[model samples]
Target: MDTTACTILLVDDEAANLDLLELVLRPRGYGRLVRVADAREAVAAFEAAAPDLVLLDLHMPHRDGLAVLAELQARVPEGDFLPVLVLTADATPAARERALAAGAHDFVTKPFDRLEVLLRARNLLRTRLLHRAQRDARGAAELAAVQGRLLADEW
Candidate 1:
């Protein structure tokens, strides 16, 4: 998938953080960006956007990142893959472990380095593209098999 065509959803309560991310990503050829200030809006935005990647902030009011992650996991179909990258100020080992266990594909600490964020986001998007291609191939193969069986029965 083209980086410029890929849609990314940014979930953070802080307007500044969301703005900063948009600033960095827009010039880097990421044209489709969705920003959500509240964690509660994350899932809705995700469903609406069908983003290729998600940048999630761990600390948010009403619903925390973990809760949002769970909702995202539930929303995604079993065979589909959605890459969720957790961004947080918490650098503790426990926090990292919890995020990973909760289905985060990657983690970035607060005050994130611009280059690192771009690189990680690129990698995750690449993975998403690959996953989608594989799923599509599997679906095509299944359809072909069913068609072949039908043709054999007719013969």
Candidate 2:
């Protein structure tokens, strides 16, 4: 997979965190990154970018990450996969549970290891892209079957 082809939305209320994320991802050839500092703007950014993966902060002003997750859940089409990785300072089990329940695919605490974050992001993106490929293949196969049936009917 082309790392550059995958667009990642980096959402954090803190500028430093966003910069750190960019620093971490850019070196790995993830060139298409959309950074959103305000939690309130995350949904709009998500809509505009259609990112393959999201790095979200749990606590933010205006709207919390859970709210953003809920909005994203509603916006995402059923049966489609959009990976959300929660990155926050909250390490409590309850926080993790809440985030997972709210549609986050993975959670990492703040002061996270660079390698761990990178690996998690890579894994999520891999699964998401593979799911997309499988979906597309199924659609193509279904179209072909319909075309075949139409041809048979004509004959």
Instruction: Tell me the lDDT of candidate 1.
Output: 0.93
Candidate 1: misplaced stretches above 4 Å? Answer: none
Best by TM-score: 2
Check candidate 2 and list the clashing pairs.
none
Which 10-residue window of candidate 1 scores lowest in summed lDDT? Answer: 1-10
Task: Report the lDDT tens digits of candidate 2 across residue range 1-155.
Answer: 65467999999999999999999999999999999999888999999999999999999999999999899878999889999999999999999999998889999999999999999999999999899999999999999999999999999
> What overall lDDT, based on C-alpha atoms, would model 2 receive against the true structure?
0.93
| TM-scores of the candidates in the order shown | 0.95, 0.97
TM accuracy, model 1:
0.95
